[model samples]
Target: MESTNNIIEIKIDSYDDLVNHIKGKTDKCGDLRDNFIFRGLSNFEHELVPSALRKDNLNQPIVNDYVGGDLGLLVLISNEDVKSNFLEDRVHIDLGYGKWVSFDKNQHPFFDNNREYLKNKNYLQIKRETYALLKFLNIADKNGLKINTSYETRSKIHNYLNPDKITFWPKKSFFEIISLAQHYNLPTCALDWTYDYHVALYFAVKDILENKNNDGVIWALNYRLFEDNYNESNEYKLRFYRPEYHSNPNLRAQKGLFTFLINPVDEILDCPLDQVICREIKNIGKKNKKTVFDNGKDLILIPPEITENDIIFYKFVISKNAKLDILEELYKEGYSEDTLFPGYGRVIQNMGNRVMLENIKNESDKKPKKNILLKIKNCEDIFQRKINYLFGKFNFNSEIENIYIYSPESQEIKGYFKANEIIKNSPNLIWEKYHNKSNWLKKDFNNYFKDNKAYAIRINGLIEFNFPFKINNLSMGNQFMYIEPDNTDINFLLNFK
Candidate 1:
């Protein structure tokens, strides 16, 4: 009998052990059919074995399915939504562990240009991330740093940079560079997955610690099965990818894989995959209505064919009780920061996580002291009429617009504003709110200020700043709206109240 110590095998004792871990928090009516555990040695197993088959032994024989032979198991952490959320309602509804689907973190904002460029435009993000990778390579070259890159990588990056060059590089090469860029912290569409169960648990537990309120999930899916499905289906255009990039030590350590999202956003913004497919079908049917290839099934935009019986997707929801235990077990098994992140620099970084001073406070913390010399009370409400008047005239878009749906013209104007810090006679009504006589009259408003006779002014256009004008109900014993530019005080609306 094998030692049952292999990283590939799930550490849980039996099927019952796994079930018992989640059984406490799981609702009685919760959908458990989609949820399955690996009874065998290798986690990659098809056919959901019944809980009755779980004996005292850790190792069990694997079963294969005709449809999905042996796919990776996916673990999903249910957000425990009482009613289905936005993403849950739209994407992969059936594959969810519970009634709710997987939680979408929706792109972390820490990455520099993610919020700026890549938030809504998933297709554009692929090209942009490529460009960013090229830029990094250029910087490395300038510094005379030797990067272990191939001719393919060098050639593709060149063509990518020079748009008119008619660049032709293999998808494999492009994926390599993208993977390398991801390793170096460039925001790409690819979500990282690992084969090592311990490493996966570590990532999940780390997230759990940071987000204590929410349940953590370990999601697994068979890449091989997905690839096979892709070849057969015309609906899903995405590829189940595992990059061959071995340059990053962390990548190697984690046994990482990536799901390469291809052209995620279709023609228009927020158009669902099904809707896009429907439009394509309409167009195709109009051209050739008699096209019945696969049993009269329209081969348009197809959602990923994920089902419980297929056993391609699996999710293990780690409740609060299970998280600490799993993390401790992983730590005991030597899956720690030292092992995962090798080398002195990373080890030092890891130590910072452990060695922490007490979150103590000094004398300044105890006994609240009076800091305010004078407190201004209800000064802002005094400018209510003027503020409302300006707001009403500003022509703000009533139909809630975010960064994703921002118009191309608006994006261009914004880019210009970022570079030059001024917009010359901008037509965007959102800019109209900044227009006022008080802003133009300020002395600090120099050549940067572009003001029209209608008192339509743009001030510090690109930079984020607090309101330039403050409503002073009592300044020098008089009520007025104060605007300061280079020590010059401009007041508007003399006291009547």
Candidate 2:
């Protein structure tokens, strides 16, 4: 364990070590896995669990001591320590003239049909684009859109856009436009965050299960503490801005919040560049020590603050052995891909993770069948699409297999039907817990399936069932399925051919 710049690093060999360490800090009793409130750094003794090793009883002064001080923990549960700065959004943009870069608040970015321009060098073009963007924002604000115009400079922009000269204005708000741009993957400085820590953990470890040789991490930060620091002298150490969230389903499903970086030119100016770009920049810097780009063109940098030593930042490194337990715990807590990401795209990615993790859980099965039950527990709309596609491709028939559909939401059997029964009377098999009778055979039947409303599928399918919608849509929501059979009574069916 070491401390630098007020940030403490506790290097644990395993997850138990971390849990035990956290346990040793508090005076509470019970398992280390029990949920405990991670409050501010002022008297964690009463709140910390695993009462036996409370602060008074501990034999050593270690990293845990900071938990009760002015320090707050921003845990990143990764196999490796993260090097990216706190404000880095990890997005790059195509800034024409063969120059692509991430957002730099110190400069304006604009482009024309013939070429692109950066604000630091191309004042005329940047000014024109800024005026256009501000005009749009003003129009949006006048139409009741929530644009943050509290800045005194906005009054000048409003005057510049003077209503008398305006012929037409778009109705969408500034937030909506930025959100849409972000949704489509345009280079924007909006870094994504979530209110749920479990969701953060899910992302951190989602890919860890596949590559066991590598470790993963979850980063926890005390933004409030960070704000206090950034606001201390008002000298502008770092500019952090959170956007107003709207009705974007993906953002809502992920519990996402956006934080934009403004004027990070100085904070990140001397920070190391990305490895791929580092070599190129080093070559250019060696030739001209003062300016890397031609004509004094420079890029804005951000995010070193998150990894640096700070009371507001902390991270937890997750080892390979501890990854599964943490992932399973999160799954039980309902932090799977579907819960964090609502669409079919995320559902499928979550399904892949589920399969990998499921295989890890069932590695010791005594009697593994050639065809394991592709069962999905706590099914959602996306999972339903997956099952439909699987049944269609495999020709799953009710007569040969026992198709059990149950509503964990209502704890009732939606129906148990034979494969042929679905073909004969498809409406009878409708799970009213989600979709109603009107949607049983409709084209959009799958669209109505409620998310996170637990449903279960426990049988194999043949390649003859005609399911609506392409199989690709199945990959969107919470996808958890297993191959080894559970206690559910059913003759799993699959076409041998």
Candidate 3:
């Protein structure tokens, strides 16, 4: 563990160690309920910066070239009732003192030509435009009221042009819309944090998987510390905003909140929250003429009267090797992508992640091989005729390692087995166990003989009866179909238990 004033950094070897450390801070009687909020990074070296504020040289130009480019335009485009023509016309913005600027549909305050103006003014211009569009479309509106006309929309936009006009709407309403936009991948000044440590750990493991060579980090901030020291009169203050979660399932599941670094004088500062906090602490130390230590990076100033035990920030670096273990543990605790992000798209993404993890585990254990789908016709007469041909006479593909059996009659994939498992077992043993037994067994074997060359594979004691799903895009007459490794269906099948 390395300590720097009020910031402590701990290197964690495994998931258990991470949990134990968090429990030590949270489980004590003196600890306030939900004292800490966490944010996870894929790389331990990453700084605590919001997505919109990150200074990416290559992408910054693209983000600034258009309004809401960094934030995403999906929220704007998805509303069918909201016409784009409302914002297509050129409009003049008053910069005060008779200085005026014109911005068309493609131009924004963030453009290079507008760089001479104050950044806070530019930031407000973007926000006003975004809020106006949202209000015009009635997207996630608390009252669900629409602006009805382009004139009304323009009026709302013009109203927010002035700095003092921000107070026109209730504070909660303003933050709610911005938070909603942020949730949908729009770039915002706020950083996302979760009250649940497990969610943070899950995201950390997820990041480590994507960047396999890099170690992950989870930053835990003492919520009580921020709450205790927060002053409304401070020139620079950190504000915590928890939007109502009823409208956003993802936020509710993740127990998410946002931390905003507010500079009343400037309104915008392109620095991480930790650095801002450290700077404020350092200034306080200097005012009192107390001894202060600064590392220039990850600095936190502690007064002489304060003890090290009152540390407010912690960073835990987790080893990349523990990624899989942590993910499995999180899944068991119901902290998975499907739960955290409730949507059809996230469900598919979760399955893809499961498939990738399975492939990784399989590759680590043995040589990887291809998986194939074997479709069969479900009929008793067809099975009796092809029983002799499919058991041993018919040659199976050597490259095919796993065979998934599909039934046409039921339109469902019944189960699967390893190609070698079925081939190594004698034909007599398979026939004895499955032949003339249950009706379902007969249908499964019958499908193998429909096309005379054993289109379907027979399932015996060697086969695993898991992974049953409906066969998609296959015609009723198409009894024998071979699926390649790259087929999209493989992702769903591989996710089976």
Candidate 4:
């Protein structure tokens, strides 16, 4: 079978949870099911099957549902709440397995028959995983999902369940192939985010295989020429796809997703993925904190922005404090030499950076597709400079917003091309429908920065400009460059002229 169709099919993004809801599931239960949706296979009809943990051959003519039919659907549900401190209630409510009901690992296949599994874990996480997996299995049981229940299917399922995200922590274990081979009938898979060491190593390799190819995985390891890209200690990682010991094109390609994870705030940020070895899959609650091997590792620290620092400048470090001089902040956390990020000035200094306000002149100055370069005398007049930077992430983000909204002057924000009936019609820069507090600031230039005294206004009484500012906390008064009345800097209006 073609690899595309020959997949160990699973579901994740598209299964509606309404069916489970109707079954009188939890009120907060998810309406969408998450699963391993694989679509690629080589054989289907008659394939060799392995005897499961039972050590006996599976029944011949494996149940149609049992034979990985059209696709493989393994739905897993987690009973653990993800947050419960089982350290106190460390005893497992013995149902079948030995009397050890603990969750050092996250993706333990949950069974409806087992209620003791519901221990300390995120209510939402376990809910999403558990119901999603089970639902897939139920569907497969009834109609025979496509996939084989053999050795290869097991390997793939294992890859999908544990995933690469968990290797940062090794203690975050999952069921062994033997145990998994025991209970599950149809292709089954699960997801866990527990903090563990040994498990992280296995998952790291598995993650490499499933997600990337060859060049990809190796690249995940921060290669060191002179310990410039990474620290010497960080270089202690082992490359799983090295040609001498490891030579698998498929395995190497999957490693590309690996990143050099560094957490400076926490003592434990060494949750290595591929090159760096990490076993730091902490409890589900720790969202983005760095996982260190012990609580003693020094984390990269940056000084918080002291608004009163007399020097109204900024530095560009890892975004710890809300403020810094500019984006040029850099300090070495590890032994590496090359600055991880080259600060903000380098970004703003680019000539073709194309701020939104300048885009109109840019497009107008250029023909259709030939090296588009537009020049403007003033950055303020053509359009508000701040808006351009705010929405620059999208080549079409401005267009989408314009089609949906209007502008400050009630200009009915649209492409200037359509209104002018010009030859090469370009969309207008201002969006009228964008009737939020942001546009309101543009409506009144004087009072815009009146409320917040910390503004850095410029441009003769017309527009505002702000770059690299996260929109959430910023207001016209606190952090913006505006043009107020009575001031006439031709730079603002003359840019368009």
Candidate 5:
């Protein structure tokens, strides 16, 4: 009987034999085999899952094959628009006897995936360990090179490993160093992150050096790993299409062009797959039980891609009893008055900016998904990053703690509380429940102009009023706001006092 770990490692040559055994195995443990990424490989009708390169995480061997025992340890780093201070060229070396060495100072390795301690790193130790592995493999010598040292300025590897002694000498490009390793048949792997053009260029240089089999790194623009542009670096730069992901194996070589896909996740469901469900779209103090993004206020997506003519479609679903006032605040903050709230869907129920979304449930002993769904799409890029804003609002589960809603009118001291409350109380307003319960830590205020009306105040994205009241457009830091509307409705709301 072969172990499951073996299934994770190498593959057997017999398809019929593998299928019968996999079927028998599936019968016992509730079809666990199908869940693996290499499910077909288990059935023998599949060939071999190609070997991902060796890893170089600390305390873990640099040569540890990604396709190992039961599970292939995957290393991923965050690929976001926001720049990382740690993402840079680094030289790591191992000086034997556990005395690992590194060249980068105050640097960390960025692993985009959920790697084993791969998300973590100690720069010095990593370099030492890496160097040691090279020396162990005779890729470099353990002679009189600077072992443990930091370089604020650009220095040479000869400071550590003797530059005078190597089959492939170090050169100008860092890619050349990794290539030197390839020359020695040392398998190397790096955390695959979303390589923007610049980063892609950098990785291409390294990949070329280590890759020899002419596997054709020349991936198509649509192929996975290929981003915006795949350069045809003819001589020094080369790329090829691998057929692994295509429909046919014979067409693999010529067909596989590198492209970028959504980040890989263990489960398909986790990716959200173009279907972003607005589980709940309300103000900060509502109880729709959705996840919240950022510290609070409005959801914030840093370095959000702002392209002209990009449309943001937003769908909000709330219970009939949820706070409408919070939704109003969100709308006002999320969009300017120019934003069109087209259809004639009059306000039925209200609570802050978050209105009565879907159906209201009694204080039942159970919970369920919201029934009502409201959809809104914002067109224009930076004019209003509504898509990023709405996507942020859906992540309402994790409440923000330091989020404070300042009441300019209230002279009283209303401080921080895990559970949100109005600064004090509105003189002529009634407050009601909002759809912000998903974010419990931040204070959510929904004030009502009338008895049943709800409005939450806003400081950042915190709802301050009880009514879904849209305060006239005011800058984030600016205090005074003058409304000069070209229409009658705008004129009315401005001087309604």
Candidate 6:
């Protein structure tokens, strides 16, 4: 353990070590559980800055980039009269360059062909635009209104749009609107933290299972320090806010709250909130008398008088190898995606994590099967297009075989298809569908020579797995790479009914 910049950094190698260190801290603090809050980051390199405050190149049209991705549909308001009326003053025409779109009241175009338009707007404008969009969607959902668009586009984005011209807005407060947006994953300045340390630990190690190169970190904050010195007039003060959880079941289940910097000033731009808090504490300590502490066995000793210099923030760095074990332990304790996020949509979104845990729980009874793992790109989109099984050119000697379809985006085995029949050329119906809709498939088809024949493996049925699995010695560059499944991988494949 090392104390630097008023933050105590502790290295934890195992789940037991993490629990014990947290226990020791609580015991030393006289078990004031409510005074402490914890937040977890899957990557140790990530800072405590909010999504809106981060200095990243996010210069894309908000409606087409952010909202379209979530809704899984593109927005193309083709009605010329309607587009002209709504976008007359709101948008600037860029002609041959990329489309021009406005988000805030100032009507500043967020994107251009060169991607330099975002620099004109400040962070506050971006934040305001995000909040406005969320508020409009919330009101639209409440009123059961749909955006006027094509049937497919409307169906996809119907959950968050209102096309009717209305002057009235909802009665909800500003913070309440942004809070709901933050909970639903729309970026906001409020940073999520949980009262339950185990929940924090679960988030910290959740993503490390698939990508094991980076260590996870849990940020334990002693809120008592901030609460004791909280001032309403202080512009740089950091305060915690807990909205009413009666309407938010996920927040209630996770025991979550948010820590918000009162005012994100120019001086603190791109600075981590933890570092800012530590700097403020150090300044406060300079005004008061200092007390020396004894550092024995790398454990920080707190002085009898709780001063600003005391260890208020703790960063627990957990080893990457312990991620799977920690997730298994957390699963047994009922901290899972289903429990933490109570919704059908959320369950589908986190199906990969859920399947990984399911495989871990049912690892005892399993038999290894002769299976080939087939890596595929855009599996989700492919499934959405009603393509049940994948057909590609492969070199195989077997007449019948089990195939596991893997998606690189989810970093998991999406599903399985049993192939038994082989065709010399692409099937007429499937080829027609792909040629009309899928550009990548059409490109592949055009690249093949007339003499070099292609084979299509027809399958009996498709079974969706949607779980995370790591494959050793598998090259991502190969489209149809075959590998022998280990015991764990075999167990996972056998469980795929």
CA error at residue 117 for candidate 6, angstroms: 8.4
TM-score of each: 0.39, 0.36, 0.54, 0.19, 0.18, 0.50
Best first by TM-score, ranked: 3, 6, 1, 2, 4, 5
Which 10 residues in a row give candidate 5 its minimum summed lDDT?
213-222
Highest TM-score: which candidate? 3
**lDDT string, candidate 5, 1-497, tens digits:** 22221112222112221222233332211221222111111111211111112224553434443112222111233333112424222213322322121222123232323212223232222333234334433323345432222241124433334322221111112232332333233443211212122122122212222222111110101112122233322111112212222332212211112211111122111221112111111221344222132223222111122122221111111111222222233334432112222122412212211322212213221342221111122212212322221111211221123232223333211221131222222211112233332122223322212221222322233222233224243233322112235435434632352
Model 3 lDDT-worst window of ten: 72-81
In order, the Cα lDDT scores of the candidates are 0.36, 0.36, 0.55, 0.23, 0.23, 0.57
lDDT of 6: 0.57
| Residue lDDT tens for model 1, 1-497 | 01211111122322223443233322211222223211111122222221211222433211110112111111122545423333333223344454312211122222222332122333332334455566667677789965666786686645653322211111445666556555555554445566665676676655433435444545444444445546353534334445553557777877766644334233321232223333444454345222122234333232344332333334555444345445555656777677787788867755553332111113213533211011222223212322211111121111111111111222211110111111122222223335452323333333333231011312212221132223233232221111223223221211110
Worst 10 residues of 1 by lDDT: 397-406
- Give model 6 RMSD, 1 decimal: 23.1
Per-residue C-alpha lDDT of model 4 across residues 111-138, encoded as one tens digit per residue: 2223334332333132223233334434
Instruction: Give per-candidate clash totals.
Output: 13, 39, 4, 97, 96, 0
Q: For candidate 3, what is the lDDT?
A: 0.55
For candidate 2, write residues 1-497 as lDDT tens digits.
45534333443333334444444431112222222212111111122121111223444212132122211111111222112222222223322332233222222221112322233322221222234445455565679865544454355554542212211111123334444344434323234445555565565555556564545543334455444434222222123333454555556665555433322222222121122122333344234222122223332222233333334333445555446666777777777877765778878887887778888767723333232223223435423544442212122222234443433443322333333222211111233322432224544444433221212233334333333112222221222222235523322322311
> What C-alpha lDDT does candidate 4 achieve relative to the native structure?
0.23
Work out how many backbone clashes candidate 3 has. Answer: 4
Q: How high a TM-score does candidate 2 get?
A: 0.36
Higher-ranked by lDDT: 2 or 5: 2
Give the number of the best model, judged by lDDT: 6
Report the Cα lDDT for residue 173, model 6. 33
